[model samples]
Target chain A: MTLVDEIKKRSVHVDAAIDELLPVVRPEELYKASRYLVDSGGKRLRPAVLILAAEATGSELKSVLPAAVAVELVHNFTLIHDDIMDKDELRRGKPAVHMIWGEAGAILAGDTLYSKAFEILSKVENEPARILKCMDVLSKTCTEICEGQWLDMDFEKREKVSKAEYIEMVEKKTSVLYAAAAKIGALLGGASDEIAEALSEYGRFIGIGFQMYDDVLDMVTPEEVLGKVRGSDLMEGKHTLIVIDAFEKGVKLDIFGKGEATQEETDEAVRILTECGSIDYVKDLAISYINEGKAKLDALCDCPEKELLLQIADYMISRNY
Target chain B: MTLVDEIKKRSVHVDAAIDELLPVVRPEELYKASRYLVDSGGKRLRPAVLILAAEATGSELKSVLPAAVAVELVHNFTLIHDDIMDKDELRRGKPAVHMIWGEAGAILAGDTLYSKAFEILSKVENEPARILKCMDVLSKTCTEICEGQWLDMDFEKREKVSKAEYIEMVEKKTSVLYAAAAKIGALLGGASDEIAEALSEYGRFIGIGFQMYDDVLDMVTPEEVLGKVRGSDLMEGKHTLIVIDAFEKGVKLDIFGKGEATQEETDEAVRILTECGSIDYVKDLAISYINEGKAKLDALCDCPEKELLLQIADYMISRNY
Candidate 1:
């Protein structure tokens, strides 16, 4: 089967598991609000990564399904809170949780998801020691994510941010969860620590690549395909790698951080970034990271699941949105 | 030592553990924000309960220090988020975390504490299976706390809340952490399930009493001692047990939900509630709960730690503020 088809098979299981694991019960509105963003679908990429990693390490789908769901819940919890922090009103083409339920409701909903992730994860049927290790990894990843977000917000208020700072922020904000997912999958599948470490490295590199390419997508992808306004990072004054690289090259774009730009102005800015090679620089950097991530998987034995993992890494940079 | 002195001894250890386990690291500002309220002095009652329970179960203070710190972090985490949701300006006689760092900062700070709680709890020196159980209890307790907060907020929007519903809210919002603390202490101390179960019950009952007494204190304690405005709960129209009972007895509170009240108006309302026996009714109920809590400790051997546990239960209802 193609990688997409394989992921779909697993995604269906994850959706079912989420429903069974987290039902709307008492205080129904809070539960509904917590489920709101999770139900509004994305690619379910994080859960796919987790399940694929576990499968590659010889674990069956059923054994790791709860872990997959836990990772996905953590991802959605971060998104709900991030959207509120960023004041973004739309998520997955629907109104954000805060938009519908209000900020207090959104905060509580995110918190519920946060706690439930741990609750479900601790119940995953595994050796107690291995499960404890995974819990450590997941919790540490969460703390790092919060730090990454804090830095991201802090960067917005500054005049300039270093490339190193931008990378650290991305690594914490986006990549660590992916790293945790792969590492956890390997550990739960009973892989040796060495192999688990490699899988974690693989996830870390590709996650960074995925986020870097996302910056490129914002500049180049059509708004309709992108599902949000194009060039939003520039409009919002985000210190993404692309903008940082452009700034380092002494490229001047008047619309940078202007909060809003005309279509023609956005086009002009994109044109300048393209001519200056900032966009290509980020794209090539993303590709290199994906390759590095793929190289780490050489530790695993030759298997179809490993091949699928490689394809997923390539897809990270190759996808349009 | 007096009960106060005994608790003070454990509180000091918890404070030092807090400093060591959650030091100011990179992203100094965020760590500072996370540590702000935690450092601000409160009674440290939850951590004391945890250490005392563990001691009663034949555990040393050093062995369960991390778990004790973990529970304290959870308590402070709830306070930080609850203040933001309730929009309370002050906590523990200082500005709330949200007031100091803004909503986004406060949210991130609380999230950090939450993930750190799990992270620290997982590292506690114990058999993996036992630690995992503690993790389950803590995570489930957190989810219940969210449900409790949601119910508390929901009750504010309605005109009348049943006494049972009010009890449920108080149980979730205030007492579950206490229960978790005691239960975790027992588990880590190698207590049998039966004993741990009893300690959990002990915590649950006293936590309810503690909250009910808190409402009474708000009405009767001097502002200087209470550390906030007197009768603030009445002004804010919180549906505490006292209010629900008074409403049931057909006692009208003109100042209820008024958001502010003159000194004379507040005095008149307190006088009316006291004259109608609602205040006395809640006080008696609180004492009964405390007594019930203390009775649960009868399963323990006649030890000083057990005596201290009994004393702590009495302290739950006896303290003026």
Candidate 2:
């Protein structure tokens, strides 16, 4: 079975883990707000991926669930605040946390989550050193996430943000968390340094690929499949690689320059994306990252734990949802 | 010189720490917007107090600067996002960070601060056990702060927030941090468990007193002396201790019913408080807490660290700032 399927096979246990982890922030004022976000359903990808990565390294998967839950909590915590910052109205097909709790509640809940994540980290037994190492990674990754958010906001106003710059932004914003997730799983499983390092690298590349594919999907996916509003990035005036590439390829798009992109403008921007072969450009990048991520996983399947990780890579880069 | 004074004496180093912590969130879009808010000048009270508390417990005063700086960074981080959620406009006689950075940048900066604090916390090198204990205190203290903030925001809509409720709120909001600061200092100094416990009590009681005094000052102090606007809590329609006291006393006011405070009725609400003698009532409460804080430090003067603790109590409850 795939990692998701494997996790699903023990869904009751995984569900209980998530349930246990959530009450830490439940009594606070923003309880409903945060719960709205957390319960706003999804596949719980980060936690699942962490487990799979742990299992892929020839370790007992259940042994790393604490780390798994911590990664998931961290991911959701960021989502709670990021949605507020991004002014996103919906998350996981429901009203966003901030939309329900108001911004203050969302913010407090986010803070609560951050502390609670550390609380969970402190609770991990028999692996004090590994726990501290995971915390260090988490702390630095969060810093990089902040840097990425800052750059993202900066890029909105700038005339041009280089493709390399775009890569750096997403790496910090998206990939570092993935890297931390995998590394933490490996650490918890007592994987060798080389194996842990490889898992981290695999996660990082796949994470970037996932984001690149997401940007492309935002530009092309039907509303029925994407669930989020069509052309939401264009509406936000965000310079995704698709738009940046088109802008570079001599597409005279006034929308990204000085004026705002309206519904019609948003559609045209997406259409231009199609005409300039931007989707292909992004797909190529995604594929290269996927290939790199797969290479890192080459040694894993030789062990019994490899199936879950390989499945994770396939599921991550290929999923349309 | 007292520890606060000593810290100011080393303003260059403190300034450097400030500069370093600031960049962790610089890339955040609203960072520039909130930079003015975050950079608003204030007494670096928390860090200075941390340094003193550390020194008072027999820790090498210099050895705790990283922790001191960490405390301050965490404090600022909380303030940045707090103002945004409260939708309050001014901090430190300037615009609130959200008002400057927009809500998103403000939120992101706060996130960065939360993460960067762990970085600073990780820098303490003397005793691993000490470091872990400090982290434990900090993690719990942070959660307490969040809980307190949660209550503070929740109180706005409730008709009856009791005196005990108010105390509980402040305990979470303010006291825990002070307790942790003193405890962390003692840990670094290798103080006896009894001594550390007592010192923590001293800091906690003092912190509670300080916040009560802050509320009283908000009622009585001139706007300029407070370095911000007068009647801010009233204007914001906060369910403060004074307001709660007045509410519980059944002081007849034009406003009633369990609902969030409104800006329109704030002036009238202040008049009601004055008529009901609530200002004096709250002041007495502040004095009682201050006395309790002093009692916690009664035996400490013999240790040479007692003076540091004593002077801090005076500063906490007596100083205009």
Candidate 3:
């Protein structure tokens, strides 16, 4: 099967598991709000990473499906809260949870998903020691994720952010969950500690690359294809790596942080970034990170699932929008 | 010792454990914001319950201290989030976390505390199976707390809420954490399942009474003693059992849900509710629940710690604030 087909084959199980594990029960409105953003369309990249990591370790997908679902729930929970924090109104082409349910409702919805993630993970059929280890990994990752978001918001208020600070923020905010996914999948599949640690590194590297490439896409992708305004992050003054690199190169883009730009102005800014090599700089860095992530798979035996995992890492930067 | 002194004796250790287990690290401001309300002087009742249950089950204080700290953190986490959702400006006689750190900061802070709770709980030295069980209990309790909060916000929009519905909300919102605390302490302390379950029931009953009496104290206590506006719940139109009973008896409360009421108006409403026996009815009901909770302690052998647990139940309703 193609990479997308392999991912979908596993993700369909994740979708079915979500319904069975997290049903819309009492206080129907709350459950509905909690399920709102979760059910909306998004590529199930995180779950796919988890399932592939487990399969690469010679485990069946069914054995680690709940852990995959738990990781996905954690991802959605962060999105719901992050949208409220960033005041983003749309997610996955739908109104953010806070927009539909109001902030209080959205807060509760996110909180519910947060707890349910743990609740579901604890029920996974595994040795208690392994399950406890996964719980530890997931919880610590969540704490790091919170720290990352704090750094992200903190960076936005300041006039300058070093590349090191930006990468640290990205690692914490976006990458740790992926690390947790791979590590958790490996642990549940009864991989050795060394293999689990390597899988976690694989996830961490690729997750960073994925986020960096996302910044590149935000600058270059068209409005219709991106599903939101192109270059919106630049207007919002977000300190993505591309912006930091361009600023270092002394590239003058008048529309940066202006909150709005005409199409021509946006085009001009993109052209300036391209000429400065800042855009390509980020693209090259993202590729290097993805390559580093794929290198971690050397610990795994030769298997079709390992090849699929390598392909997923490439897909992280290769997918346009 | 008096019940106050007894609880303080145990709570002191919990206070120390909090400092050790949840220290201010990198992202100093975020950790500071998370620690703000936690270090504030609320009576450490939940931790007291956990430690006391552990002691009653022949466990040493040092062994279960982290679990006690974990429960305390979860309580503070809920308070931080609930303050934002309720728009209550003050908590523990100071500004809420949101007031100091902004809503986004408060949200992240609460989320940090939440993951830290699970992270800390998972590290307690114990059998992995028992620790995993506690994780399940704690996570499920958290989900129930969210449901309870949702029900509370849902009730505010409606004109009437039945006693059953109010009890259910209270059980989920206010009591489940207490239940988890007692159960976790017992499990970690090596108690039998039957004994652990009884202690959980003990916590559940007293917690319900604690909240019910809290409503009564809101009416009868002076502002200086209560440390918040007396009858604020009334003005805010909270559907406490006292209000539900008063409404059932055709006692028209003019100041109810008025958002503000003069002292005279508050006093008049208090007198009307008193005369109709709604206040006394709730007071008696709270006492009965506490009694039921104390009765659950019969499962334990007679010991000083068990005696204290029973006294703690009585103190739930008897304390002025």
Candidate 4:
């Protein structure tokens, strides 16, 4: 089957499961604010990867659905809170939760989703020990995400952030969840520790690449397609790989974190970074990581599910948004 | 031991445990923001109750210390977020975390604490099944607290929230954690389901009374004693039981939720609520609930720990802040 078909099929399964799990409750606004983002359209990439990873390891689709839904909920939870902190007004082609519900409502909504993720995880049809391990992975990932966000925010104020530091932040901020998703799926699928670790490493690499591609997309994607401001990373003074590369390549530009920069100025900054070959530099890095990710999957048995995993990584780099 | 001394002793244990559990981490600001409020003084009431409840059920205090610390962490997590939402600048006699770290830092700090709570809980030395069950309760309580917060916020915009509605909100927002704390303590202490439920009921009742007493204390306590804004709740136009009772008694209250009301006007509102016997009425209710809470100890085997549980209930009603 095509990767698109597989993603669509798995997304529907995960979405339905999420809908069933999060019933609307009293004080309807909180739940509504939470469900608002969940109900909105997304690729559901994390859960799809999780389900695919489970399938690749010889597990039935049903076995991993709860964990799959859980990871998606957690992903959205982070998005909601991050949007609030970043003060982004748009998400997934809609007003962000904070925009509609206000920060308090958004905070509570994000928190509810965070708590519900664990509740759902506890209900996964697995032995208690395995479930505990999964919870530990998830909680640790939560801490890393927070740490990454702190670093991301802090780096904005720093004069210089090394490429290694930037990569570490993205790994914690973006990739840890993905790694945990794949690792959790593999673990719950009865894979041995070595196989699970391999899958986790594969996910970690792909996750890092996915984030680098996102950084590139922020500069290159259209506002309408990205569903938010373009060049926001530049405006926010975020130290994306392109920016780091440009700084190393002697591209003198002052538009970094220029919140009030005009569109022309922002465009010029993007142009400078692109002309300096920093954009291509990041693209190459993304490809390298994706390749490394695929190599880690060689530990798994050859299966169609494994092929889909490779295709998903390719799609991560190729997607416009 | 007297309740005060018992509280003091247990507070030291819980505080030390919490300090050990929450080691400082990288990106120092986030962890610092989290620990800032934690290091400030609190009565450690929840943890004390948890320890007392566990001891009452024949469990060693050490066995339940992690769960006790988890509850306190959860409590602090809610306070950090709620302060941001409420826009309060002070907490526990210090500038609220948002004041020091900015809203973004406070949000991440709270998220870190929240995730850390579950991490700590997952480490409880118990059978996996029991640990899972404890997690289930804690997660559910987290949801209820969110719901309760939503209701509290919703009630502010409301013209008249009935006494029953007020009770239910407090039950969700305040009592649920206490209930979880006690239930967790009982379960980890090897108490039977019946005994756990009894202690949970005890905590729930006391939690409700504790909040009601807090409402009264807000009106009567001086700012220095309360360690924050006194009459802040009234200023927020929250419908505490006293306010609700006065409204029911046909006492016109212009000071309720008077955000811009002068201190004199606020005092006048409090005076009216007090004159209408609403203050006494709520006080009676608080005492009754505390009594009811103590009755739950009837299910426990007689011991010094159980006697301490009874004293703690009385202290909840008698304390100023």
Candidate 5:
């Protein structure tokens, strides 16, 4: 079976687990808002990747279900809050949590999911030391993600943001959770420190590549597929890697950060970005990171699961959006 | 020392510890907004309660400093987000974080502080089992706090909320953190489970009484003292125990939830509440809870710290605001 089909088969289990675990609380709107995006559905990629990582280490997949659900909840928590912060009106082709439930509802929903993630993580049925270690890893990653988010917002206001700064932000905001997921998966699967570290590095590089491809998709993907405005980041003057690279090449885009830009102006901006080869430059960087991610998997035993992990990395750079 | 003086002395240590641990992140606004309420200052009651609880169990105060700081940070985080959700303009005599930093900034600042609190909690120098236990207690409390906040917000839209329902909401929203702080401090300080549970009960009861007193203060305190609009809860139609009791007493409040009511009308509403004996009824209940809280201290050994914890319970009911 193809990697996508394998992922789909595994995601069915992950989705069912999450559905059962999603909080059922009084004052139903809070739980409803929290579950909204989860129900609307996406690839469930984080949990799928996690289960695959655990299985690759020759461990039982069922034992790692709680951690898998916990990571995905954290991911969704970030998305709910990020949408509110970005003031985006749609997610997964439905009204964003904030747009539907209002900002206060969205904030509470996100917070509930966040705290629930840790609560769920605490129940992972591990040794006390390992449980504490997992909590520490997840907590530190959470801190980094929040800091990275602040930097993303901070970048929008600043005149210059280096590629290094952009990469660090993406690593913190986008990649650290993935890194932790793989590391924690290995740890839960009883892998040695060396193997866990290798898997973590793989996830980290792949995460960065996934985000780079996301940056490219923002410029190239249509609004219908993307679920919101195609170039909302550019309109917000976010110094994504593409924007930073374009500025370095002396290719100034008219619509960068201009909230009032017309569709024609945004199209022109995308056209300029494409002509200046910034999009291709970002795609190349994404490919390189995916390659680096796949290389880390060489430490694991040669198995079908390991091959799937490699295919997953390639899929990161190759996806349309 | 007088109970107030003891609290003052303990608060100095808590404040200083917090000052040192507060995140000094880039995008200075997030940190600034977070520290804003902390810097402007009020009673560091939560951490002091934690330390007092530890001391009551004959535990070293120094060892639980990280836990103390963690609880305080979580308190401030709730304040930041709660202010935004409530749309209150002032906190601790300064513009609320959202007013100064914008909602997005405030949300991020609150989130940064929330994540930072757990990060700090993980650093507590305790046995792995104890630390993990603390994390579990803290995580569960965090979840309750979010749920309670949602309920508080939800209560604003609904009529006929019961006193029992209001108590549960306050327990989750206001008291659980206090309960967790005391319990975790006891565990960290090497107290037995029985002692920790007793201390947690004490904190929980005191927390309820404290909120009851706060509800009373909203009517009696002037704006300068409360650092918010007087009767803001009433203006928002929050069915505090006072409101519920007033209704039971056949005292219909003309200014209740009338956001446009003149100051004279609100003052008249307060006068009627006082005249109908509803405020006094709520005050009696607050004192009862405080008395019950003090009773929990009977389980601990006789010591000055235990005496002080009893005095602290009394102080909770007697505070002006």
Candidate 6:
């Protein structure tokens, strides 16, 4: 199948897996909280890549579905908790779990999803080794995600952050799990350790590109299309690459903007960022990183799935909406 | 050894184990939040029992300590998350994680402990099977606890709850982990299934007695001693056996003296319970459960450490403060 067709098919498979896998225990708080997050309508991109990557390696058996589904569940679990932490209002164009159910329920719902991820994982019969590996990866990813959040929280209080530091944060926050998605799939298909490592690197690159592009969207998209603030990243004083570059450029240009700008002036500051070509710098950085990611995929020799991996990588960098 | 001395030795052991296990991560959030919970001087009773139970079974080899510590970490994980969900304030004479750090930090901290539990368990180099089984029991126990929380939330919205219904809640909320703890220790020591099952039953009954004693404490200890609520279960209109009996007797006396009291008023109407010997009834009921729990312990024939188990059971019923 073509890359577009592959993603569409994998998306459908993952959606079905989620529908089948989420058991409603009491049909009340546990299930209701789960449904609240599950129905929020995520891209389901991680799981799609999981199943497709597994298939691309060799087999297209139904056995890959559980880990694929678990990835999606893990993704949503992080989102529910992240939304509560970020105090975000809208998810998939509707009220966030916490906003709708209070911080308490949002927390409970996120926890339920966390436990449920294991519940789904523990049930996958074959590939116990792979599942264990995935669990380790997932658990490590969770810890890494927490660390990234701590750094993000700390950024608001600090003055200067380097480009390398920004890359490290995004790699932890975004790329690790994305890397795990493809890596876990390769493990499921009995791929070689070298090949698996390459897939992980591939994910790491795309994850950075994906997050960088998201930052671009924050600055450039219209409010209605974005479903929240345009330049909300700036308003929140997020130390994303664009903002980081803009600040450095601003300093080089004798700009006194170190930190602690008022929220009301966020856009004005972001406007300064665009005027300084800070936005362009961020964009260029994303392209190079994405190209390096594609280069890593190209370096995965003797893998029949290489072309498919390349197509998916191209699509990730180019995606919109 | 006397019960007090046994508890002291076990407390020192588990406390040290917890101390060692917490620093497995370098980032401060995981360790700080862990210390926040552990340093609360929580009596370390659960892990204490786990160690003593393991000792009573045969070996206090270094292997069991991680399992012992893992259970405690799991317990704290549940508490941190549950407190956030329940919006609780003071725990062990200090502000809850959510209260001090806000809901987000508390949630991440709780998740970190869950991760830390596995990390500690993964360190059991002497008996890897025990570690895996311990994790299995813990993961499953956590899942049940989540279900119980859901039911508790559901019961808050319901008008009537039966005694049988309340017992089932106690099983899920309080007893299962105790059961698992004893069974895990025995299994780790290579105890026969029959022995493990019997000890597990011992743990379960003792757990019931422990919770029942707690319920009785709700009636007698007053809020000042507990550092929170005296009759909180009553105030929350929780359908504990105490309030369930109050409902029965209140209905019997047609004591609509207030002409249709709210559940809150009815809960407060436990004064009416005092007049009608309902508190006495509660005390007697708890005593019977303690007796039943002790009887189950007694039925475990031919054990050298039976005295210790029996002593622990006795302590389960009679301890105050």
Which ranking of candidates, highest lDDT first?
Answer: 1, 3, 4, 5, 2, 6
Question: How do the residues A11-58 of candidate 2 rate in per-residue lDDT, one tens digit apiece?
Answer: 455557767766635354455555556666656767776776767665
The residue-by-residue lDDT of candidate 1 on B14-102, one tens digit each, is 99999999999989999999999999898899998899889989899999999999999999999999999999998877889999999
Ranking by DockQ: 3, 1, 4, 5, 2, 6
Name the DockQ score for candidate 6: 0.37
Q: How would you encode candidate 5's per-residue C-alpha lDDT over B1-321 as one tens digit per residue?
A: 788799888888877777777756665776787788777777888888888888877666777888998898899999999999999888887888999889988998888888878888888888999898888899889989998999898888887888999999999999998899889988887889998899899889999999999999999999887787789888888999999999877788887888756789889999999999999999999999999888988888898888888887888877776
Every model's DockQ: 0.93, 0.56, 0.96, 0.85, 0.75, 0.37
Off by over 4 Å in 2: A10-12, A24-29, A56-59, A252-272, A298-301, B2-14, B20-39, B192-194, B252-277, B298-301
The numbered model that scores best in lDDT is: 1
TM-score of chain B of 3: 0.98
TM-score of every candidate: 0.99, 0.90, 0.99, 0.97, 0.96, 0.87
Candidate 2 interface RMSD value: 1.7
By summed lDDT, the worst window of 10 consecutive residues in model 4 chain B runs over B253-262
Q: What is the lDDT of residue A275 in candidate 5?
A: 91
Write the residue-wise lDDT of candidate 6 on A116-216 in tens digits: 67667556554545556666666677677766766666666677788888888788778888888888887887778887788788888988888888888
Candidate 1 chain A lDDT trough over 10 residues, lowest sum: A87-96
Off by over 4 Å in 3: none
Q: Report model 5's interface C-alpha RMSD after superposition on the true interface residues.
A: 1.0
Clashing pairs in 1: none
Q: Clashes in model 3: which pairs?
A: none
Model 5, residue pairs in steric clash:
none
Question: Could you give candidate 1's per-residue lDDT for residues A1-321 as a string of tens digits?
Answer: 878898999999999999999999999999999999999887888889889889989899999999999999999999999998999888867889999999999999999999999999998999999999999999999999999999999999998999999999999999999999999999999999999999999999999999999999999988788878889899999988888988999998888889999999999999999999999999999999999999999999999889989999999988887
* Tens-digit lDDT string for candidate 4 (B1-321): 578897898888888888888888788778888888888887888888888888887788888888998999999999999999988898887899999889999999999999999999998888888898899999999999999999998888898899999999999999999899999988888889999999999999999999999999998998898996778887788889988888889998776666767778878977887888999999999999999999998999889988888888999989888
Question: Second chain TM-score per prediction?
Answer: 0.99, 0.87, 0.98, 0.97, 0.97, 0.88
lDDT of each: 0.94, 0.74, 0.93, 0.89, 0.87, 0.71
